[model samples]
Target: DIKPIEQLNINNLINKRNFRGIFGTQPPLSILEEIDYIIVSPGVPFDIPIILKAIEENIEVISEIELSYRLSNGKIIAITGTNGKTTTTSMVGEIFKESRKDSYAVGNIGLPMISKIDYSTNETSFIVEVSSFQLEGIKEFHPHISAVLNITPDHLNRHKTMENYIDQKSRVFLNQTPNDITILNKDNPITFSFKDKTPGKVILFSRLSTLEKGVFIEDNQIIIRNEEKERLLVCPVSDIKILGGHNLENALAAVAISYYAGIPIQSIRKALKKFKGVAHRIERVDIISGVEFINDSKGTNPESSIKAIEAMEKPIILIAGGMDKGSDLSEFVLSFKNKVRYLILLGETANIIENLARGQGINNIKKVASMEEAVLFSFNIANKGDVVLLSPGCASWDMYSSYEERGNIFKSLVKDLRR
Candidate 1:
């Protein structure tokens, strides 16, 4: 049975070509007779009653990316991680565009792979940014080049365990052969462990130490050494405009993915210089009364927010808390030491985070009802040279539709602070 969730636009759902008016709130306990195959979206948990019923009955269960991969003939450069997927995917997309290749960036970078399949040819290239949710249901979704940026605790509410989440993220390289490439981050322990497991050739990227054959920073220049031991200098680290140590990792992953995909060095260099970053990720919104405001509303988990907190140079008046995703916030609360001056909490997880902070001996916290109150509370407490960061460390589903909507609302409120 089809379940087009009620929260979405009904008009848009009905307008789909050849869409039959067949939707239900819940599936029958037994789907064996009528349903032979079920294509589940990433948003829906695989353990849901209907999908579990399909599995129990031996019905084929797959994801949209798996279906698109079966139908499309294009080369796929798929990247997945707890964070940095969007930035790396878009950076690789821009690098391909510089090469004048017939390529599209899809799969969670705002577009679905199936939608772009109709126009793709054998020569087409698809740079896909996949989430663990999207990767969880895959059976045969393979990419020509796959990169796992870093693994962290996210979507624990759905996956139920970090082990399962890591396995799902690793599935991006599940179908690869010896000819394909798997790029991994050396600094991230879980990601680096995959180097030995992958059948395909492995490429490593690091910010800490030099690699025998991978990408590394040498004398402040971004350099890559392939399996053939050929060294190529792409650009200086200064050429990268994106802030934070995490984004540097993203740039390294993008370079490895794009360069291995046969994109020219000149094109990669030019693209690296031109691409700033995707929105809602540590994006600087504005400054009011010498206090800066940043839109990191995309920081929907503790690890992501931790990175945002580390990226800031000035004292922070942080606005955090939203729909709890079952993440451990002890590290998030502990990191506030000497960094976060005031904590403005909102949404469903407000009390949870507040309690965690208080337990950590952090008492400079305020709980608010809405984004407006959070923004105003932060502004009132922020001083000159201090930054007001909106890194929620929780999903926006409790208060807003999406992270983008949350970020836009934060931006709108911050803009109004001037008035």
Candidate 2:
């Protein structure tokens, strides 16, 4: 390890201090004056005082993605969007592995790209699940193939505006050339519009329509096309083990990325059939007394919870609410009109969601003080055919450190009920 910055004598630093080493957390704002470059992390807001100061002073700011790109000697397929990124990235990585390629699934999926750059060689492939936070600071971080699965109203609290968020997401392909590939969701109006702006060969994927030039479902089989000629048949949509139509869209995206990476159709199909989706994403926790309990704690925004709600075929008692991210709850509340028979809410946004539900004429709303209370209350009211879903439409930071913690607590509470 390098010498500690704390090793510098305070008196000497008072006389002549220069940056010495990394700050474990945030260094003193005074250190900003001595630094010439600041590589911002994704979690650090761009409007923070130090960042603003850097911008004012013309200090170079780049994301870890940019640093990794500069150091990489491998190919990258970066996936970004408001949702479906983790599932798609994992699927792509599995397909690459099945096809016998050296691949690492990094970025927002967990591992930082910067931590894995030295592990890359010419044959290594990186399947990155990027977020707008990471993209906002990128300068020349271009991927060999990039896909924006879909963009919706998400992270508005961070990016502040829908326009700004879209612009940041577009940076994924900003530096790509005609030799590279850009994948877009044809059904998403925002992402589909980027076809004209993409500098590379734009390929579109659709779960709702048959695309002339990308990937689409026809007769329940996933197919790919290029220049009006059908290239390959990936797997039958029904063969995908993941539940929901939303997952079908994710499958189409992963198939497009893996196939373009030269993975064979058989390998893609094999991966699709085996991949059972990621945890905390519409994951089935347990069933007791003929009632199903599903954990979707990863649904931290309105649009994501709406998808989870739409995927439910049985009557559901939804347990929602968490730290508010300044998302609109109108659409999310309205989605409960059909399937959600009972709404059990908790956390900071519980009252806010309950109010929205009442406005939508959803009168069966109950607010709880804790996750255990919410689960027990839901179990009390749930019928034999009803499903209890914990798809919180807000962040978990108000009560827990992460969504994973929230989901684990929910799972544990549900298991305790079984005993």
CA lDDT of each prediction against the hidden true structure: 0.90, 0.88
* Model 2 C-alpha lDDT per residue in residues 1-419, reported as the tens digit of each score: 12244643354654486646554355567877787798887878888777887888889888888888888979989999888999899999999989889989999998888788888899999899999998888888889999999989988888889999899999999999999999999999999999999897988899999877889999999999867586668777779887788889999999889877888889998989999889999999999999999999999998889999999999999999999888888888888988899999888888899888888888998888999899999999999999999999899988987899899999999999978
Model 1 lDDT, full chain set: 0.90
Candidate 1 lDDT at 121 equals 92
Reference-based TM-score of each model: 0.96, 0.92
What value of lDDT does candidate 2 attain over all alpha carbons? 0.88
Measured by lDDT, the strongest candidate is 1
Candidate 2 all-Cα RMSD: 5.0
Best by TM-score: 1
How much does each candidate deviate from the true structure in C-alpha RMSD? 1.9, 5.0
What digit string (tens of lDDT, one per residue) describes model 1 on residues 75-175? 88899998999999999999999989999999988899999999999999989899988887788888989999999898989989999988888898999
Q: Residue 43 in candidate 2 has what lDDT?
A: 72
